[model samples]
Target: MHDLEASLLGGDRDLTLRDLADRAGPGVRPEDVQLFWRTLGLPYADTDERLFTDDDAQAVARIADLERSGRIDRRTAVTLTRALGHQSERLVLWQVEALVEDVAQRRHLDDISARLVVLDRLTELAPVLEAQLVHSFRRHLAAIAGRFAAEFAEARTTEQADPSALPLARAVGFADMVSFTRRTAGLGSTDLSAFVQRFETAARDIVANAGGRVVKTIGDAVLFIADDVVTGARVAVGLAGELGGELEVQARSEEGGLTEGHRGVTPVRVGFVQGRVLSRFGDVFGASVNVAARLTDIAEPSTVLTDPSTAELLAGDSRFVLEPQPPRELQGLGSIAPVLVRQA
Candidate 1:
C-alpha cells in the first residue's frame, strides 16, 4: 500500500515541506505550497513530514512562475488551483466508487471486501485512468475554445468585457424529476441506481441533441445551460416533448401537464430563462438561475416554463409557440409572468 503511493504520485514522497519549497523554485515558499494544498481541500502536513513528491514540487513551481511572470495573480491562481482540487477529488471518487461496485458484483464479495480489493488493484489502474482524465480534459478545453471563437468572433476588440455583469448570455435552468421521493420510496439499491442512471442518460441525450450543455445532475434534477435563447428554448421544449406533458397556457389554468408514466419513464418539469449568468466554481449563479428554478417549481409535471423575457425572445422563433401565462409572484424574484413553451 505504501509503495502504491509512489506509483500514483509519479515519484517517491521523500521531501519535507521546507525541502519541497526550496526544491520547487527560487520564488516558491513553504506558505505558497501550503496555500496550494489547503485550497485543494487537503490537511496541512507537519513541517518535517515527507509526504510530498517531485510532482507536487513541480506543480507549486509552475504556479509560482505564473504569478512571478504576471501571467496570473494570486487570486486567479487560487481559483484555478481550487477548481482542479474540487473537480479532481470528485472525479477520482466517482471512478473509484464505480470500480468498487463492479468489483463487488464480479467477485461476489461484500462491499468491504471489494473496497480492499480495489485498494490493491488501484496502482495497476491508476495510469490508464489518469491518461483518460487528461485526454477528456483536453477535449473539453477545445470544446470551450470553439464556443468562444464561434460566439465572440464578431465582437469589437476595443470593447471591454463587463466583469461584473453575469459573464455569459446564457439560458440556464433546472429540470426536476416530478414526484421523486414518492416514486423512489421503495426501491432497492440496484433499482434506484437504474432509475437515476436512466434519467441522467436520457437527460444528457436530450440536452446534447438540443445543443445545450448539462451543467450537472443533482440526485433528482438536472441543471442545463445553452449559449442562446433559441437553443435554450429548444432544450426546454425538447425535454417536455420527449419526457413531459403540457402545462396550462394561461396562469395556472386547469392545473394540467401532469400525467401517468409507464415503468422506467420518469416525468420532469423544466424551467429556463434567458439572461446573463455568473459562471463560477464550475457552476452558474445569479438571478436568472434563481428565476428559472422558481419557474420550474411552479411548473406542472412534464411542463416547461420560462420567464416573460425569455418568452419574448423565443416568440420570434418559428420553431416554438409561446403562450403568455398571467403574472405569478415567485419567491425572491417578485412578480413574473411565466410563459409555457411548446414545440410548433
Candidate 2:
C-alpha cells in the first residue's frame, strides 16, 4: 500500500491502476478500481486491469474527498464530471485543429505530407508541449474550481441568496450583415471570398477606429461587446457607415455603372443593442448578442437597427439620423420597438 501510494502520488509516469488497487487493499478488486474511474467520467475504457496516471488518481481522490465531506451529491458529481469531460474534449479538438492549420500554413505544405509532418513533429515535441499545456490547463481549472468552491460555500451559508454572484457590467452588442449569405450566393467562390474579406476588414477597422474591440467574427457577423453604451454605439454606427460606403464603391467599380443605391456598391445591415453580457472563453453571450443578431436579420440592406436603449444613448449624436420604426414582434424577444440610423 505504501509503495502504491508513493507511486500514485509521484507524477504521470509512475502512477497506475494497479497501484490504486494495491493501496485500496486486498478486498478491492481490479473491477472496483476501474469502476471508480468510470464514475469520474473519464473517457478511458478500463479492462479488468488498466493503467492510470497520477493526475487521474489525484482527481479521483479529490472527488472522493468531496463525497466524504458531503459537498456534492453523487449524481450531481457525475454530471459535473461529464460536463468537464465534454468541455475538455471540445477544447482539445479546437486546439488540435488550430495547431494543424498553423503548421500547414506556416510550412506551405500540401495536405497529405503536412498531416504526416504534423504528427511527426508533435511526437518529437510532445514532452515539452504536454508539460506547458498541463501547467496552463491546471491553472485555468484551479481558477474555475476556486470560483465554484467559493459559490458553494456561499450557498451553504446563506438561506435566501448567495453573495458570490457573477460580476455585472455595462452594455454590449454585435454587428452583422443582413442577407449576407443570400447576397454572396450568386457570387463565385473567388468573388465571395473577396467580399467576405472586405466586410471583415471594413468592420474591424471601423470598430477599432470607433473605440471598440472586435471580440470575434462569426461567419458574416462580428461580435463587439463594449464596456459602455457610448463605445458600443460608436462602433455600431461607424461600422455601418464605413461598410456601407465601401460596398457602394466596390459595386460601382465591379459593374462600371452608376445608379440610385449603386453610387458605388451594395451595403450591409448592422444591428446594435446595449445590455449586460457574459464574456467567456473568447466569446460573448447573453441577451445582448441575441438581440443584436436578430435585429440584423430584419434590418434592410445598408441600414442600422438599434434598440430603444441604444437609440437613447445616441439621442443627441449628430453623426447619425435615428428614425423610429413601429413596434414589431420578434422571435424569442416578443415585441420590440427599434430605430433605424443612417449617416446624415
Give model 2 RMSD, 1 decimal: 9.6
Q: Which ten residues in a row are the worst by lDDT in model 2?
A: 249-258
Write candidate 1's Cα lDDT for 12-103 as tens digits: 88888888789767877788889989998878798789888888878888888888899999999999999999998998888998898899
Clash total of candidate 1? 0
Give the alpha-carbon lDDT of every model.
0.83, 0.66
The positional error of residue 81 in candidate 2, measured at the CA in angstroms, is 6.0
Compare the candidates by lDDT and give the number of the best one: 1
Tell me the lDDT of candidate 2. 0.66
Q: Which candidate is the best by TM-score?
A: 1
* Model 2: CA > 4 A from native: 1-42, 47-51, 59-91, 102-108, 123-170, 178-218, 241-268, 276-290, 316-321, 326-329, 332-335, 342-344
Residue 156 of model 1, lDDT score: 51
| Model 1 alpha-carbon drift over 4 Å, by segment | 157-164, 245-262
